[model samples]
Target: MEVLRIILTQSSANYKKEETILNKMTYPLPPFSTVIGAIHGACGYKEYHKMDISIQGKYDAMHKEPYRDYCFLNSIGEGDRGTLVKLNNKNFLSTGFDKVAEAKKQQGSSFREGTTIQVMNQELLTEYRELKDLLDRIKDFEENRVDKVLKLIKKRKKDLADKKKKVKENKEALNVVLIREKQIKELEKNINDRIKAYKVNEYEIPYSNFAILTTSLKYYEVLNNIELIIHIKSDKETLMDIKDNIYNLKSIGRSEDFVDIKDASIVEVVDTIDGPITSEYSAYIDYNLIKNECVFLKLGDKITANGTKYYINKDYVIEDNKRIFNKKKVVYTSEYVAEEGSENLHFDISSEKSYIVNFN
Candidate 1:
């Protein structure tokens, strides 16, 4: 069978494991789904394409990198804490926010009173304080004036209903009372609409520009000098597209994990071989292949070598507006051997290349 063989390299990368939180952990290699997604992205395919991949790679070293994590609060309350920021755009959290001030003391530091706080940007601080004052005024108006008017309207409606009951004996006068009650209801609705417009424009819209954000230090596990050998098995058209746009494959693990394409070619490979072939690089081997003895793990005096079992993600289908991934169960190891007449293992037949392909 002819398969697309790609050799790639990255200076630094973090193929993050999904379960990790504070310290973003990195996988031994990029998962199956990551490689597939990267390939589709490079080709600029809008939809998922059917393909199977074999990922094997090595990294020079591993290290922990530090970064700051920011968590923004949904709404500010009395005695607010954390760093105060003025958002460049309303109602969206992006890199477009300017730091107005931060609490010098973690607790009991007031952003509004400017107590024990450092003002980074005086203009933004003034803007934030003005917005806060406007919000307070809006709240006071709603409670003292708008709400009182609504209560008076309700009481007037009740009084009209009482007057209608008293004039029940006179049909014409009762009809007039009902008409006046209807007019009062219409006036109340207009007042409510006006109040809503006032609050949305004066309070909610302006308040969205200011946010209280908290920060924490976190670390990421980064792999350095990554070398990856990927094999792609798909239709002829898709393979040709990838080969044509091989250089467009930018990153695999993260946006910062930029890739450099070394080689891209079609190579003939055979599932059955006449002699033993051992893996030269660490690879994700199908667990079923290991279970059936198609691939053996033996090195030096160790007859039974063990490897880390990973349920690596491959493809995914969107169900209920969320992606449900198809995971492949594989064993990650460098010490794997494939002997004569193997079912799942493949040996590259290229005269200049020697590779043991274990597609999971």
Candidate 2:
């Protein structure tokens, strides 16, 4: 029987037709009884028809009591017809299960996306806070350094002021010393000229004569009168007599009485006699009286003179000395005479002494 069943099952279309007919009749399909029904129904035998009807009637009564109220039937066909029964309770359960699966999938995708956004936001917040802290620290550092730099600048300014004050004081003191030295040099020159003119070997000259001579000559007019004058008088004779007697009458002089008697005369004659002179045989030079010692006129300096050349000296005198040598002289002696040539045309001369020559 099993061999014959295997042979009959080889025809699939015939088996499906019998299965469809049995399904529509409301048969309770047996466990392992599909083969038997398929064979009997496909054979279409009269004896098997009676058995199939009886079994189908019993299946219909069972279905009417329970499955018939909730079940529905539908047919779908592709190449052949097929019947499908749907239970209302099964459809509801299947729809609910599909909805739950879809929701789970959506929730999983959303959870992954949300987690990534949250992590990124946290990292950004952390970076922003760090940057803010760094900025605050840098600002504080710059402020503190600026304060220190300002303090240093102020101190430098104070130090510069102090140095400037010291420099000013030093310059003032130097000017005072220069003025004093100028005055002293003027006085010394006047004393030396008087001694040389009188032919006095002694250093001490009468103070009375010095005062009278200096005042009458008007030397160093810029100096205070009181500072230049000194008083030294004797009952026997004047200071001029003392100076003449000490030098053994080596210098020329007139009576002090004559000067005193002519005191009321015109001031022009007295001034001319007392003024500086550059006469022959005199040690004094006239132009020396006007020039300052610190500032000398060179050869290129502009000048006006009657003679060949004249130079200004670096000292001043109030009176002329009669018995002195003033002019310079030069002498040349040669015995041999030679023809003029380019090699002999030039002459070179060197001297340690400086000659005073004027320029105009």
Candidate 3:
């Protein structure tokens, strides 16, 4: 079988594990889905093109890099407890926010009174205060004027119902009472709608623009000096397109993990081989292949050796507006050898160096 083989290098990279949060963990090699996604992105394909990928890579070292992670609350904090930030743009909680002020004392600091508070942006702080004042005024109007008017309207409707019974003998008087009741109902609806519009447009929308956030120092497990050997098995047209646009491949893991494509070429791979073949680099070997005794682990001096089992993400289907990822069970290790040939294992002999191709 003919396959597209690629060699890529990255100075520093982080293949993020989905479950980790505080200390962002890294995968030893990029998953199938990540590699496929990168290829699709490079090819600028809007739809998922069917393909199988074999990912094998090695990294020189790994280290933790510390960074500040800001957690934004759902709503702006009421009291002066958390950090007050004004979104550079309004109504969205995003990274592009200016630090308006922060409480110096974690518990007792008053941001509004400027007591035990550190003011970062004076203009934004003033705007926040103005918005707060407007919100207060809106609340006062809703409580004192809107509520009072609604109460009066309710009482008038009740009184009209009673008056209608009294004027039942006279048709004109009864009609007048019914007409007034309808007019009062319409007026009440208009007043309620206007108040709602004012609260949302004038106060809530503008006031909520400022966000409350808490920050914590977190670490990201980053791999350095990563080298990846990837094989793509697809249709002839797809393989040719990939080889033609191999240079368009930017990054495999994170956007910041820029990849330098070292080589891209079409190579002949065979599934049947007589002699033993050992993996030159670390790879995500299929768990079933290892479990079924088709692939054996190389136990050097140690009594026993086994690779780490990882249920890595491969492909996904969209369900209920969420990506439901299909996972592949695989063993991640370089110490693996296929003594006897298996259907799933293949050998690449096109180049001077031989490699065991294990596709998941």
TM-scores of the candidates in the order shown? 0.84, 0.13, 0.85
Question: How does model 1 score by TM-score?
Answer: 0.84
Worst 10 residues of 1 by lDDT: 297-306
Give per-residue CA lDDT, model 3, range 1-360, as digits (tens): 899999999999889999998789999999899999999888988999888888988999999988899888787654676789878676456648888888877677766677888888999888888887887888888898889989999999999999999999999999999999999999999998998898899877777777887888999899999999999889999999889988898887788899999999999888766776667789998888877877776765322327899999989999999999989999898867775546667878653677878876
Per-residue lDDT over 76-148 for candidate 2, one digit per residue giving the tens place of the 0 to 100 score = 1122111112222443423321110001221222211222122323443343334435545545754676446
Name the regions of candidate 1 deviating beyond 4 angstroms.
Answer: 44-48, 158-174, 291-293, 299-306, 319-321, 340-344, 349-354
lDDT of the candidates, in the order given: 0.86, 0.23, 0.85
Model 1: per-residue Cα lDDT at residue 83: 86
Candidate closest to the true structure, highest lDDT: 1
lDDT of 1 by residue, 1-360 (tens): 888999999999999999999889999899998899889999999988899898898899999999999888888776768988878785568758888898888678877888989999988888778877987887898899989999999999999999998999999999999899999999999998988888888777877888888989999999999999999888999999999988988898989899999999998878777677777789998888777767777675424436899999999889999999999999998867776545456887566657888776
Ranked candidates, highest TM-score first: 3, 1, 2
- How would you order the candidates by lDDT, starting with the best? 1, 3, 2
Q: Write down the RMSD of candidate 2 (Cα, Å).
A: 74.5
